[model samples]
Target: MGRRRTGEYFSLDDAIIQGQIVRVRCGACRRAANFLPEDLAAVYGGSRFALEPLFPCSKCGTTDFVRVTTYSPEIADFGRITLRRPGPKKLVQTWENETFTERSRSNYVPDGDFRF
Candidate 1:
């Protein structure tokens, strides 16, 4: 069977089934990173989700210039390749003050009332 499509692009599930990892790079900063398809599928809906709009370079934060590719790593790449892994979640609480104020309206002058 052919690969499933989300709009015009193939789904991330296709890559996961093919045992491929997603590589994202920032063209402006030249920063690159590898991510697992399964992990992404879980967070980004399911395997059928479009791979587009998924990669926004964390370092440079440029989604327009980001490039996404997929490949199966070779055995020799085990030590050389470094994947971007998720870190522990932290929750912090903050307090904000809310104040309500009424604005005063400015006096209005019509165009005909103005003196040259």
Candidate 2:
């Protein structure tokens, strides 16, 4: 059987091509923000993924109350609306060191004895 079409747009790429912008609102905290569809698609996955499941509110960190909607911006809405654009990605490198001494070795007991 052929796949059924669910909505007007199949993917984020489709939405972007149609000049749609994504808006997310958090019910609990009343926090709202707009984002570019391409920015979200880059972070979460490719354009084939749905936009709704990709956002968790940055402030509240809850997906339960998040609402995702896409709309094409009007000329009047240009300066009035602010969008959260993607920033430069930062790669942090961390190094951990482990030291072992005779005292530390004595704390290890075999046979699943966890007493220290």
TM-score of 2: 0.68
Q: Give every collision pair in model 1.
A: none
Taking all chains together, each candidate's TM-score versus the true structure is 0.66, 0.68
TM-score winner: 2
Model 1 scores a TM of: 0.66
Segments of candidate 1 deviating more than 4 angstroms? 1-8, 48-50, 96-116
lDDT score, candidate 1, position 53: 55
- In candidate 2, the residue pairs with backbone N, CA or C atoms under 3 Å apart (3 or more residues apart, or in different chains) clash, namely none
18-110: candidate 1 lDDT, tens digit per residue: 877778778888888888888778888555544565856777676988767777777877888888777786555454555544532243336
Candidate 1 local distance difference test against the native? 0.69
**Cα deviation in Å at residue 12, candidate 2?**
0.6
Those runs of model 2 whose alpha carbons end farther than 4 Å from true positions after fitting are 1-9, 48-51, 98-116
Question: How much RMSD separates candidate 2 from the native structure?
Answer: 10.4
